[model samples]
Target: MAPAITLAAEAPKLSSANTGFMLICSALVLLMTPGLAFFYGGMVRVKSTLNMLMMSFISMGIVTILWVLYGFSLAFGEHNSLIGWNSDWFGLSHIGLTELWPGYSIPVFVFMVFQMMFAIITPALISGALADRVKFSAWSLFIALWVTIVYVPVAHWVWGADGWAFKLGVIDFAGGTAVHINAGAAALGVILVIGKRVGFKKDPMRPHSLPWVMLGAGLLWFGWFGFNAGSWLGNDDGVGALMFVNTQVATAAAMLAWLAYEKIRHGAFTTLGAASGAVAGLVAITPSGGAVSPLGAIAVGAIAGVACAAAVGLKFRFGYDDSLDVVGVHMVGGIIGSLLIGFFATGKGQSAATGVFYGDHTFTQLWKQCAGVGAVLAYSLVVSAVLAFLLDKTIGMRVSEDEEISGIDQAEHAETAYDFSGAGGGVVGSVSASALATAAQTKKVDA
Candidate 1:
């Protein structure tokens, strides 16, 4: 019957250095989800901080399970033009230890986990937009479904072996299109369906903790080294090193530009502006880091900082409450970064594709970048809106008006981020009490 069940030879030799580097990068990327939780958490009103944090934290759990079950297969398995569906790796059942991914330096398992980190953060990015109003149960359900439907397929389109964009020579060194643009569009879609947050423009709704915001932004910046440079899957190459430098350069430039814009427009260089600018820079440079020079990264970052700072106000002009500017920063920055590649790519880095500015005036690469961006944006928006609409109709997506006014953290999780009722009369006690007391007073005022 069986001619001695011959196993196929392993794909290639495993590079220990590459494997170890990837392992570190995977851990660093994993840290971004928690960093995102804190970042989003710090931006919301104190009443909903935990809920904001939970919305991001839950994605790490949900997407991890889904990735092991079938997400990996659908995303990176054997492929068609749309998506792969190989069952051989489902539940990670048959991946042999020490097995190398084909033509890659890292082991299959290490590669799997690295990709898994990407999957986790992509959905977490959406939580910033829905912020205070979403039902925790419905939000959790949305993460599972959205990642499966929108993220998986779009990931396949961009990164899978047979994905249409990958095959078309689209150069997404990281995930400007797949992750940022995808999540950004999804955020916009859900907010449109869910409508504005209760106090559309009248409420202050200012961040309760700029210190927390700064801390979270710092962590995100630290983790992004892994997010951008590690996409090369190995630190042994010059491409990875180039990307690492670009990540730093772009982020710093973006921060400066954002501060300047804020100073010019709002007449103040706020701490919040610095933090938001840095993230915009990170998002803008993600797709282009491997292909552009440090100078190019600065340009991208500067433009993104200016553009996103302005775009944030669109919520008021057109009335869609993207609570934390996910649509503005991630989506808009992603589009700018992706499109800029067609003008900045030197055809000298990891990607051999030249942009219009690099003596290639045909704009061929530019059009491909647009297609990649447009496809992900359209699919993610439509699918996310449909999911939100359905969830709103069935299980109800938003919390009750009373719950929202009171504080989603207490309403949903029965926990507060800070408790002042049991503390001593030190500075910590005084600050916590004042913050909580002020929050309670505000709730009373709203009531």
Candidate 2:
């Protein structure tokens, strides 16, 4: 009885406040996946809407199961620098209910679930670039593999206790390197292997629904407070508050900058531009928010907004078909954000590291940031390309050209985003099979 009493007394007292806060934050972060579904869903052509939504939705399902089984272990378990594992972490079977994450007030379960949400969304982000053409089965398999191969290692490198990058003093407040950059680079790699969409530059592939895009952007903005501030793991300090403020400041600044750039370069501001800009700002602030002041966040956001705006157009010049600008926005935004940390860090936020603008005259932090970015970019690009190439040669990554033209939703999922049959509209289910075939043929001819 005395020994048990002594052990209990020595155990860290659990803070209900922190636990509740993290639960709410985890819920918020989970919402971002559905938000991303709408974001990506609305960006693709109507023919591919449901398929696009499914791509994001499927990750939620696939990753949840994997996380419980071995994903969490590989990402956060105690192990080597490159990867982590503990047999007990498998199935979360060995963790005690009251066992707090070391140095934190929340239980290991809360932290694990929160990190799981990140794992779910990262691979989903890749689906955006392969929007209209990839086989759904192939994509699901890719997510499973990519998470195991790419995401787990990178997450360990950046966030795990003994990760090489984390030990080296790289700063990734949320997931600029692990989530955004990893997904973006993977998107680029897969598209390169799978080749261009059937029509490529000759077709008019505008977004099908701007309202959905705006709604998605709004939801993502709402959820990101948790994604950023909650990363601090507790509200016991002013750092979480600082992160929260920087997220909003940077997002607004980026949106305005993107709109300004759009007006100047394209002679008009667009809803897509507004949403994309907001996201770019969000991405930029993700890695730097913990380290930069609100003012520095503005710089990060503005720079990312303008840079990503310019980058989205490069696919056309380079002749790669990124279906929805995933490469330009996420990859470019992540790089801009990660590197800017070297210039904007205040040495007072989450860590004591100062940036070039703040007293570090040696550019050491910048080089470190570059190294993190370069390593993630190179590894993800090469490995993802290899994965896609292998899948392409074996099971095939793309649907047939006819299926793509006819609509991936029908061919892949046998469904559509909207039903127009009741109103006598000419959309999918409203028409006879032969008529639908004719329309598909017409679309191919038009393209």
Candidate 3:
């Protein structure tokens, strides 16, 4: 019989290399939240840019506090099959600094903070779907509650040692199901409750700034190296290196495929399309990178890129306003990544299960993947819808119509993303121009 897993009882010697690597990786993952902010913010119209950015930024602050309090405990600590808890880790008390997590080289605190970054970003991903319409206060409250109720349990299920999916032999290398799918489903549910954005298909709601989008995408790509590779928890493992290489390959392939699709479908290949494709690739490869070969990564990326590009249009046909294609890119991409594992997983490396494509035709792993995806999708959607409904009835979920059209930036935050007043020049230059025009008019009248 396999030896039973046990906690690290002895004071294990700290590996400086592993600790430093994780610390760096943790910083990289944290950077993705702001990267997400810029990505979502740029996709929004100028009127709603600040609000979009704030939604992502707020998660950083809110989830960090929650994670420290009990989020970490509920996710990683010992508990029942569904969830986990340890009062000792509350506020990170009693846990010794020198102690390592079970079967890991890194310290418990490092892992806590690393996972904490994941918690912060998942709810933020949902905000993109409800952009331009959601009330800031309502969003803040939702983040706090959703992370506790929805995110915590789901994190446990996928990542926790005793969680059902983890125990059931599901292989989510990172967060294809938990983070992306969960956020995507939640976004869909909340939007269904809140209804469509005011303009829907009628308005020309093009992204205000593609440069910002490119920059954000760039940051996300850079940070994802850590997000995917760092999940290995130690740099010494060869798997981490493979994951890192696969991440880049899949993302690149996905971007190219998306561009090709855009060229074929539309007359021109747009920059925005390329950026979105890259993100789709990133999302698709995230869960599969650890298990799949480089060739598999390419396949995953290319498929995700094309699929998500197609899926984004569903909002228009279906009459739901997923403002920034969160459902398309995150939800659909996540599912693609998760399910593809059933076909592409080699069973030769880090993940020991053989996919059907590799001659394991029982489809056992496929069913497990489906279960993880279905469970997360169903739970997140139901809970998010309920939360949105309750908040709508009580505190009002959306801004007033006037607030939305006139500019959510000013109405919600009393500020705008850009200051156009001095754009013609400085304030003095505008004043001087006005004075010159007045003088010319006066002289004309005298003549």
Candidate 4:
């Protein structure tokens, strides 16, 4: 009897510990979208507050559906250099429950859901740049199209197994390039096409709620631990632990650096500056945390905090109205983090890649990092501009001047974030009482 052909190797076993860990990580990443909503919502004028929150919240709905439908296939299935596809990934219908994700101990489903959270937030990041004036329906449509055309393809390029960047040895530990840079570039593109907010530099556009910004930043800081560490796929190695440590170290350093810069440059360490600095630090450490030492992480964060603080002022000089400094913070921070990897990568960490400062004598890794960053920035900027231009010409991307002045929440959502009708017991309350009396008189006359 032809000795039954023995299986070549034992099937990969599932680790319940890793599975449970990934599930929690997925939840944490999902929390970031709502965190982002509060962050951006508080930064816009009160008139557009609810619209701002909806812009981020709607991404959770739109991207989740797309990820399940065909997004996972395009981003992570069988691949070409630019994109991926597999018939089985449609609607995630064909994935088996116990199938492990390649070398990881967790199930493929866990990996897919974890990635879905990332996809949801990338476009949401762009919403901050287009705040106050975009039509909600148009913005929703943009999320659908942008995720398909920009985000999915970029995710494949940076993270897919056969992606050109991945094969070319770009080390994006999390998503400095794929998520932040892509979203930031797209934000720049769309804003250029849509024109500026009505007031732009002329208006006194300031954050309405510092507390909301702080709360959102706090949530983002907490959730980012999962975002940075979980990219390692498992805690079997010490890399995830290192990433966790680096995340905290980098964020603290960045926050302090930003406050120092603010005190020196503007003579005040503002709460807005602290919140913005912490976010800048989070962005900078995202891609490099796994490869850098704790000390290196502090350097990355400090640099990003100062650089992003400076960059936020450029929107005025350059004539772009980036309502929330999305380009300044996310784009600049992503670039700083991704490039610093070429400088600070230790051969001892996640991979064997060493940077210029860590024994590598050549600029090869730095060049590769540049290529990845440049390609993503250029593609996202151009394509997103085209998408916005087309939408503006066809269905219209902006609200009317009348609607914009009246407030996007009332124009688009028919809801208000806060109620002032009873606040002072003044004109609004008198108007309400008069309206109620008029209604009662009309009812009596009809009877």
Give the range of the ten consecutive residues with the poorest summed lDDT in model 1: 1-10
Residues 369-428, model 3: lDDT tens digits: 999999999999999999999999999999999888898899989998888565645776
Better of 3 and 4 by TM-score: 3
- lDDT over C-alpha atoms for residue 23 of model 1: 91
Question: Residue 110: error of model 2 in Å?
Answer: 0.2
Instruction: Identify the leading candidate in terms of lDDT.
Output: 2
Q: State, as a TM-score between 0 and 1, how close model 3 is to the true structure.
A: 0.94
Give one digit per residue, the lDDT tens place, for model 4 in 295-384.
Answer: 999999999999999999999899998999999999999999999999999877888898999887888888999999999999999999
Candidate 3 residue pairs in clash (backbone atoms < 3 Å): none
lDDT accuracy of residue 309 in candidate 3: 93
Whole-model lDDT for model 4 versus the true structure?
A: 0.92
* Candidate with more favorable, higher lDDT: 1 or 3: 3
Model 2 reaches what TM-score against the true structure?
Answer: 0.93
Residue 136 lDDT, candidate 1, scale 0-100: 97
Which ranges of candidate 4 are over 4 A from the true structure?
1-11, 422-447
Query: Of the pair 1 and 2, which is ahead by lDDT?
Result: 2
The clash count for each model shown is 0, 0, 0, 0
lDDT of 2 at 256: 96
Report the CA-based lDDT of candidate 3 relative to the real structure.
0.90
| Model 3: residues with Cα > 4 Å off, grouped in runs | 1-12, 422-447
Task: List per-candidate RMSD values in Å.
Answer: 6.3, 6.7, 3.5, 7.2
Whole-model lDDT values for every prediction: 0.90, 0.92, 0.90, 0.92
